[model samples]
Target: MKRSYFSAPYAVWMVVFTIFPIVFVGLYAITTRRADGNDLYTGLANIGNIFGNEGTYMKVLWRSLSLALQCTAICLLLGYPCAYFLASKDFAKHKTLYVLILLPMWMNFLLRTYASMGLLERNGVINSIVTALGFKRLELIGTQGAVLYGMVYNYLPFMILPIHTVLKKMDQRVIEAAQDLGANPVRVFYKVTLPLSIPGIISGITMVFMPSVTTFAISGLLGSGNFMLIGDVIETQFMSANNWNFGSALSLFMTVLILISIGLLNRMDKSKTGNGGGKW
Candidate 1:
């Protein structure tokens, strides 16, 4: 009973910060005001505008999803091997390496991203190196590639850390038992390690994908305002266009989309494990 009391403050915080905002946004999204200044609920009108014949929102959504997926994929491909090495017994003596890996995260994320801008800009560090090496200077900033690069750079640690935690906590006995059964490294990994690591991979994917999808800073700074993402649109709607109702509508839609994606990922994880996932 005392433990229940401990949760009261947290519950109150969630109600105030989370639930209230969602409820307010929903109210704004579904209701319209008449000439008499009375609000009327209009079902799906805002949604239809988002997905109707205009197709502008649809394109923005697709672009966001595509970039998010690409960033997630890149993170996974890079993070897995790095995590594997860090989690290996051979490197157990070097705990400092893990701290070094995490050192970048201690710095402000925006500052780190902004620092990358300096390195990537034309005639910056990279371009200067290329020029000195008798190579053509490459245009690095204000391109889709630059935006994608920023996403990968900023979010890669999110992918690595979770998987590293999971891997470090994994039971070594299972791995040894698999080895005792004469299973080769490749076979054991595919048959056991990889399957067992699905939870971490799912966590990593969620961490990387969500922010990548909704990020405005990376795209705005690196993309030079050429690309328009759903986040950018939402910001513009509220800030520039003064369309609070539409912005609320967009936020509600994005919340739904994110929930759906998380639901699907959870379902997939559950199907693989047959019980959501086993406790560590």
Candidate 2:
């Protein structure tokens, strides 16, 4: 029972920050404010505008999803291998490497993105090097690729760390048992290691994908305003357009969509665990 006391702060935090904000946003989503700043019940009129003849919000939504999916996929591909290498017994400095991976995250996120922008900017370090070597400077910023790069760089560590944690905590005896059963290295990995790591993979996907989907700062900095995602649009509505009702509605929609995604991922993880993955 004493152990339960440790959770009190977390519970308070959830109520104050998460639950209250969500409820407040939901209230605003279903209502419109009048000229005198009094809220009037609108019954989804703001949501209706999302699917109205303009259809611009739909495009922004698609763009956000597409880039987020791409970022998630890229992070998975890159992080799994890095995680595997770090988790391997063959790497004597795995713990040191893990610390290095976490080091950059200690810095402010906006500052890190600003650093990336510097690296990718025209006449920046990368271009300067290429020009010195007699190669033409590449257009790195103000493009979809730059936005994707920012997402991948910032979120890749989130993917790698979870997978590494699970891999490091995995049961070595299960792997040895697979090998004793005459399984090859690759076969043992596929049959034992990979299945056990499903939980971490799912966790990594959730962490990376969710942030990538709702990011505005990274896209704004890297894309140089050329790309406008749903997050950017929502920011515009609230901060610039002063349309709290529509912004709240969009936020609510994104929240629902993200919840659905988490649900689906959870179901998939459960199914995988039932099939072959051992609980860690």
Candidate 3:
């Protein structure tokens, strides 16, 4: 059969939008301003500057990784059960529930984060409720906990939706056969359901982890300028510090980190499913 040319436009779009931007960033990262006000190829000079400032930058990188890990863990813990329930026969019959699960995502993410900001602020709704009950007002905002909460809240759906998709599409007979073979519900889940869901879980982890690590808006709004993440630093380097080269270098480092993470996750997925096909 002759292949259709329908993918040609999308290939062009990918080159223009994705490939071009990456190449541009790479160029910016490697080029530096010379003494005569002209640009010169620095080779690894910009990367060297990143290493020189490794003290602060590494600290920020660690914090970003830690928070992103926390957020991803929380999302998996919370989303897995929710997804399993929603994918069950009972809830699958009620499609409206799925719509409701995705309703918050339909709204603007910035708006949702801003609304979360209000709820977590010093004198926000929670504080008001606490004071109403004669308890001390809680200072939730501008803390690492608050940032972590914002990360989970924003990215939880990313974790849930993929897992639900996998579970809903899973073959029922595999689970039934396991049960028929004297497997209890828990054993069936561990041996059959959980193993089969590895692909979805890995995908969900990628979705949650990447955004959580790279996000600046949630940290900025919730942390109230108190916290400084790598994303915030990159933004400051470009916007406030007027250091595009450094920003580009940092962006390159971040991209490499994300790629490494994705590679590791893919390796784990391949080990679980064997042959890298993710098929049972």
Candidate 4:
């Protein structure tokens, strides 16, 4: 069979939109500021600066990673049961509930973050209700808690969807077989369901963690720019400081970090699957 001309268009689009832009940014990162204020060739200087001034940037990276981890943990802890519930139930009865779970995702991300901010602020709805009930208004805005909440709220669906997909596809007979073998519910879950659903868990975790790590808008809105995340650092470097080279270098470093983490995750997943010998 011969390939169609449509494939050529897609290839051209990929080169123009993705490949060229990536190559351009990488090239830009290695360039220096000339005396005439133009970006000139200066090999490795920008990358060097990234390592040299590692204090703030490294802190931001750590903060972003920490937040991403926290979000992933919380999502898995909370979402797993919900996903299991949805998966186990009849499709007709659970349809509305599933829709409710997904409804929030349809809203704009920025709007959702701002809504969280409004509710979390001192004089916002939550605080007003608390004060009306003769209680003190807790300060939730501009704190790590708020950032964590925003992250969870935004990415919870990403965690739930993949897990639900896997759980729904699970064969009920396998679970019954475990029970027939004298395994308790918890034991069956740990030894069978959990291992079987790992691919979905991995996908969900990656989906939530990657974007959460690089989220600047949520941090700015919920944390009120008080927190310094890696994403915010990149934005500040490029937009505010007008340091393209440094910003690109930071971005490159973040990309590399994400790739490393994902690689490790994939290896662990493969090891688990290999050890299990597909029994799970």
On lDDT, the candidate that comes out on top is 2
TM-score-wise, the better of 1 and 2 is: 2
Candidate 2 clash total?
0
Residue lDDT tens for model 3, 16-51: 999999998899899986768787888878877776
Clash count, one per candidate = 0, 0, 0, 0
Each model's lDDT comes to: 0.87, 0.91, 0.89, 0.86
lDDT of 1 by residue, 63-146 (tens): 999999999999999998888888988886547877887798999988988888899889689999999999999998899999
> What TM-score, computed on C-alpha atoms, does each candidate reach?
0.93, 0.94, 0.94, 0.93
Q: What is the C-alpha RMSD, rounded to one decimal, of candidate 4? A: 2.6
* Model 4 lDDT tens row, 83-151: 888888565567888899989988899998888988999999999999999998899999998999999
Off by over 4 Å in 2: 1-7, 275-280
Better of 3 and 4 by lDDT: 3
Better of 3 and 4 by TM-score: 3
Clashing residue pairs in candidate 4 (N, C-alpha, C atoms within 3 angstroms): none
Candidate 4 or 1, higher TM-score: 1
